[model samples]
Target: MAKALMIQGTSSGAGKSLLVTALCRIAKNLGFKVAPFKAQNMSLQSFITKNGGEIGLAQALQAMSAGLEPEIHMNPILLKADGNKGSQVIIHGKVYKTLKPKEYYAEKKKLWNKVLESLEYLKKHYELLIVEGAGSPAEINLRDSDIVNMAVAEYLKAPVILVGDIDKGGVFASLYGTIKLVGKSEKLIKGFIINKFRGDVEILKPGIREIEKLCQKPCLGVLPYFEELSLSSEDSLGLSYHKTFSSEKNKLIKIVVLRLKYISNFSDFDPLKYEPDVELLYSLRKEELLSADVVIIPGSKRTVEDLLWLKSLKIDKILKYLAEKGVEIIGLCGGFQMLGKILKDPEKVESDLKEIKGLGLLDIETTFYPKKITTQAEGYCNLKENLKIWGYEIHMGESEGDLNLFTIKRFATKEIKKEGSQKESIWGTYLHGIFENDDFRRFILNKVREKKGLTPLEKSYSYKKLREITFNTLAKLVETHLNMEKIWSLIKL
Candidate 1:
C-alpha cells in the first residue's frame, strides 16, 4: 500500500485544496510518484478527464501538478448543488442520482464503500497519495455520517495535518477547537499549518505555542498570503475573491458575465483576465450589462432555474436589448440553452416545470435529457476556418438550430458534427473553455476592437504555459515556508 498523508481544514475556504496541490507538486519534485485523492467533493467547478469521466477541478489541477493525468479514482464522489431541488450526485465520474439532504445521508454506507474502493485503487498505482478532506471534521452533528474528513483519515490510518486560515482571524482558537472536537480522530492529527498569513510570523509565535500546548500538535508552518495565485477554485465560495476585475478606464474592451446563481465552470473565462486590453466583470446589474462591449452567459448546473432567476431580475430584457444593440453576446453550455426561444424539461430532469420560455435571443430550442454528455471536443470556427478550438463539453440535452457556428469531433471518436449557433453579433455554444483558445479568442476580441476603431493587440500569451509556471511557483512557495523535512518524515518518504 502507498503511504498516505491528509490535509484537513478547520473550516471551508481554509486553503486545504491548495495545500494538497502544493504538496503534490513538492512530492513530485522529490521523485515520488504522487497523486491526489478526495473521498468526496462538493463543487460546481469540474473537469472531464481524458477517459470522459467528470471529476472535481481541484483534483484535476492537483493531478496536473503531480505530472499525471486526472482520473475518476482521484475524486470518487462529487455532489453538485441543484438549488432547492437537491444535489446531483456523481459516483466514480458517472451520474448516480439526485438526492435531497436526508435522502443522501441514507446512502452513506454505500457511498463509504465506493470511497474505499477508489482509495484502494489509488494506493496500488501511486507511491504517495496526498489526500484532501471536505469541510471541517469538527461538525459533531454530522460526525456519524461523515465519509470525507476524520473517517477517511482513520480508515487509511493517514497522518492528518490541520490547516487554519489566519486571515479569517481566531486561527489559534479554530485550530484548537477542531482538534478537540474530533475526539478519537485527534490521534491521527500530526501537526497544524496556519495559512494566508499577512503580517510577521513572530507575533503569532506565542499563540502558536499556546495552541501546540493545548492540542499537543506541533505548528508545521505559517504560509504567507499570495495574491497572484491563479489556480482554479474548488467551489462557488471562491467566486467573490475571483471578481478582481472592474470597469477600468485603461481597458478598452469591457466584458460582463452574468453572475448566475447556479453558475458552474466560471474558470472558462479566466484566460480573458490575462488580456491586456480587456476588463472582465461578473455582475447581475442591468447597467453593467448595458455598458459592456461583450456580454457572456456562463454555464449553470440548474439551467431552467437560473433562466427563471434571470427573468425575475429583469436581466432577460437587458440581454435582448444588448443583442439588438450589436453587443458581442455569447452563451456557454446551460447558458447556450437559456439563450434559445424555449426550454422543455419533459422528464423533469432539472425542474417540475414542463417547459419554460428562454431569453429568445437565438432561434434555437433546447430540451433537457436524462443523460448528460461529458467529453473533450475539438473543432474549428465556421466563420473563421483557420481558428481551431478545443474544449470539454458537460451538459444535458441538445439544441435544434439552423445556424451552426463550429464543426467539432468528440475525442476518441471519428464522427464529425456541427455545434453551436451564431446570428450576427450573438453567439451560443455548449463548449466550455472556448476562450482559452488563443487564436479564436483573439479573433473575437479583435472584431470588437475594430468596431471601436481601436488597434487590435497582436500578441497573446499561452495560458497552458502560464499554468505550468503557476504550479512550479506554488510548489516553491510551499517548500520554502513549510517544514518539508518534517513533512517527508511524517509521510515516510
Candidate 2:
C-alpha cells in the first residue's frame, strides 16, 4: 500500500488545489510515483480523461504534473452544480445520478465506501498519493457527514497539512479556528501552510508563531504571492478575480465575453489574455458590449436558464445588433445553443425548460436528451484557410444546422461529425478549448484585425507550452518555500 498525505484548507479557495498540484510535480521530479486524489469535487471546470472518464480540471493538471495519465480513480465523485438547487452526480467517471443537497447529505455513507474503494485502487498503482480535501473540515454542522476532509484523513491515517489564505486577512484566526473545530481529529494535522502572503516573512513571524501555538502544530511554510503563475483554475472564483480590460488605448482589438451566471470552462479564453493586441473583457454590463470588436458568449452549465437570464437582461438583442454590424460573434457549447432559434429540453435534463425561444443569431435548433456527448475532437475549421482545430465536447444537447464551422473527429476513435455553424460574422460551436490551438485562434483574430485595418500579430502564444511552463514554475516556487523534506518524511516518500 502507498503512503498518503492530505492537504486541507481552512476554507474554500484557500489554495488547496494548487498546493496539491505543486506537490505532485515535486514528487514526480524526485522520481517517485505520485497521483492526486480528491474524494469529492464540485466544479463546472472538468476534463475528459483518455479513457473517456470525466474528472475535475485541477486533477487533470495534477496528473500532467505527475507525468501520469488522468484516471477516474483520481476523482471518484464529481458534483457539477446546476444553476438550480441540484447537481449532476458523477461517480467513477460516469453519471450516476443527480441529487439535491439534502438528499446528497443523507447518502454520504454510501458514497464514503465508494471513495475508500477508489483510494485503495489508487494506492495499489502509485507510490504516494497527495489527497485534497474539499472546503473546510471545520464546518461543525456538517462534520458527521464529511467524507472529503477530516474523515478521509482519519480513515487513511494520512498526515494532514492545513493551508490558510493570508491574503484573505484572517489567516491565523481561520487556521486556529479550523484546528479547534476539528476537535480530536486535530491530531492528524502535522503542520500549517500560510499561502498568498505579500509582506516580508519577518513581519509575519509573530502571527505565524501565535497560530502555531494556538493550533499546537508547527508552521510548515509561508508562501509568497505568485499571481503571475497561470494555471487552469478549479472553479468560477478564478474568473471573479481577473480584471476586465477597460483601457482600449493600449489594445488594438477589444473582445467582450458575456459573463454568464452559470459559465463553465472559462479557461477557453486564457489564450486571448496573453495576446498583446487583444483586450479581453468578461462583463455582465451591457454597455461594455458596445466597445467590443468581437463578442463572445461563453459555455454555460445551465444553457436554458442562462439564456432566459440573457433575455431578462436584454443582452440577447445587443448581441444580434453586434453580429449585424459585422462585429464577430462566437458562441461555445451551451452558448451555441443559446444563439440558435430554439432550445428544447423535453427530458428536463438541464432544467424544467422544455422549450424556449433562443437569441436567433443562428438558424439552428437544439434538443436536450439524457445522453451527454463527452469526448476530445480534432478537425479543420470550415473556413477559406481550412485552419486546424482541436478541442473536446461536453454537453447534454445537440444542435442541427446547415452551415458547418468545423469538421470534427473524436480523438482515439473513428467517430466524425460536421459540428456547429458559421453564417457571415456569427459563429457557434460545441467545442471547448478551441482557442488553445495557436493557428486556429490567430486565424480568427487576424480576420477581425483585417477588418479594422490593424496589422496581424507576428507571434502567437502556445497555450500548451504556457501550461507546461506554468506547472514547472509552480513546482519550483512551492518547493522553494515549502518544507518538502518534512513532507517527504511524513509521506515516507
Candidate 3:
C-alpha cells in the first residue's frame, strides 16, 4: 500500500477540495509523486476526462495541482444532478444510466467495487495518494456503504485528517461529533484540522485544546480565513462574480449564455471570463439574452428539456438576432444539439420526446445514440482561415452539420481525422471543454473583439499560464494555512 492520507470533511462545503489541493501542492513540493483521488463525488458540476468520462471538477483541479493530467481514476464516480429528484450517475468513467432517488441508493452499494478498482490502481502508481472524502463520514445513515469517506479509507487502510469549518460555527461540535460517530475501527482519522477561522489565533487555542482533549487526536492547527485564492468553483454554487473592470472601453462584444435549469459543464465559460475586453455573462431570464453579440448555449444534462427552457426564455430571438447580424453564435455538446435543425430522443435517454424543433442556427440534426462518443481530438478551427488548436470532445448525441455553412477539420498527429460541416455564421460542435485551449481561446477572444469593434489586448493570458497563476495562488494558500511538516509526515512514501 502506498503511504496514503484521507482528508475528510465534517460536512459539505467545509473546505475539503481546498484542503486536498493544499496537500497535493505541498506533497509535490516535497519531491513526491502525488495524486488526488476521490472515490465518489456528488455535485452539479462535472468534467469530461480525455477519455470522454466525467469526473468531479474538484478532482480535476486537484489533479492540476499535482501536475497530472485529469483522468477518470482521480474521480471514479461523478453524479450530475439532472434535477433535484434524479441524477445522471457516471461510474468508473462509464455511464451506468440515469437513476432517481430510490433507484440510485438501491444500486449505490454495488458501485464500491469500481471505487476500489480505481484506488488500487492509484496505490500501485503513485508514491503518495491524497484521498478526499465527500460530505461527511459522520452521517451515520450513510456510513454503512459510504465509499467517499470512511469506507474508502478503511479499504485502503489510509489515515485521515478530518477538517472542520470554524467559520460556520459549531466547529467544536462538528469536530468532536464527527469522530464520535464515525466507525472507530477504520484505522483512519489520526488527526483533525480546523479551517476558515477568523480573528486572533489566541482565541482558537482553547477550542483546539478542547477538541484534541475530547477527540484524543492531534489538532493540525487552525487555518485563518483568507479569500484571495482565484480558483474555479467545482460546482457553480456559493460563487459571486463582479465586473471588477468595465468592458465598455475595451470591447463592445457581449456574450449571452443561456442559463438552463440542468446545465452540466458551464466551466467552459472560464476561458471566456479570463479573456480581457470580453464580457461573459449568463442570462437567467429570457429577455436578458436578446441582442447578444455572441449567444452561446452551454452543455446540458437534459438537452430537449433545456431547449424547451430556451424557448420559454425566448433565446430563439437572440439566436436569430445574432444570425441576422452575422454574430458568432456557438453551441457545445448538448448546446450543439440545440443549434441543429432538430433533436430526436427516440431512445428516451433524456425524455420520452421523439423529436423537437431546434434553433436551426447550424444546418444539422442530432440523434441520441446508445453509445456516447467520448474522446480527445486535435484540430484547427475551421474559420475563414484555419488556426491550429486541440480540444477534447465529450457528448452523447451525434451531430451532423450542413456542408455549406459550418466547417471544422478534426486533426490527429498532423493529419486530418474527420471534417465538420459549416453553415452560415452559426458554429456547432460536439465538444464540451474546447475553449480551454489557448489558441482556440485566443481565437474566440480576438474574434469577439473584432465583432465588437474593439482592438484585442496585446497581453493575452495563455491557459497554461493562467493555470500556473491559479495553481500558484493555491500553493500560497497552502504555505499560509496548512502545517506542511505535519501533512508530509502523513504521506507513507
lDDT at 252, model 1: 68
Q: What Cα-based lDDT does every candidate model obtain?
A: 0.89, 0.86, 0.74
Order of candidate numbers by TM-score, starting with the best: 1, 2, 3
Across residues 1-493, which tens digit of lDDT does each residue of candidate 3 receive?
5778888999988888988887788778779889999988887566656656767888988898898888899998888777754877888777787788678777766788788788888889888888998888888986665778887787777888988998888999988888888867434678888888788889778878877888789887777786633456666553335232454544545677777777766777777776656666777554545556677778887888889987886768767876887877878778888887888878876677988999877777888887656555665665646665556565666766463322333321233444344466677666556777766667666766766676666646676677767777777776776676776677534
Q: Model 1 over residues 331-403: C-alpha lDDT tens digits?
A: 9999999989999999988889999999888889998899988888997999985779998899999899755
Clashing pairs in 1: none
Q: How high is each candidate's TM-score?
A: 0.96, 0.95, 0.89
Q: Name model 2 segments beyond 4 Å from true.
A: 238-251, 384-386
Scored against the true structure, residue 7 in model 1 reaches a CA lDDT of 97
Q: How many residue pairs clash in each candidate at the backbone level?
A: 0, 0, 10
**Which candidate tops TM-score?**
1
lDDT by residue for model 2 over 88-158, one digit each (tens)? 99888888778999999999888998899999899899899999999999999998899899989988899
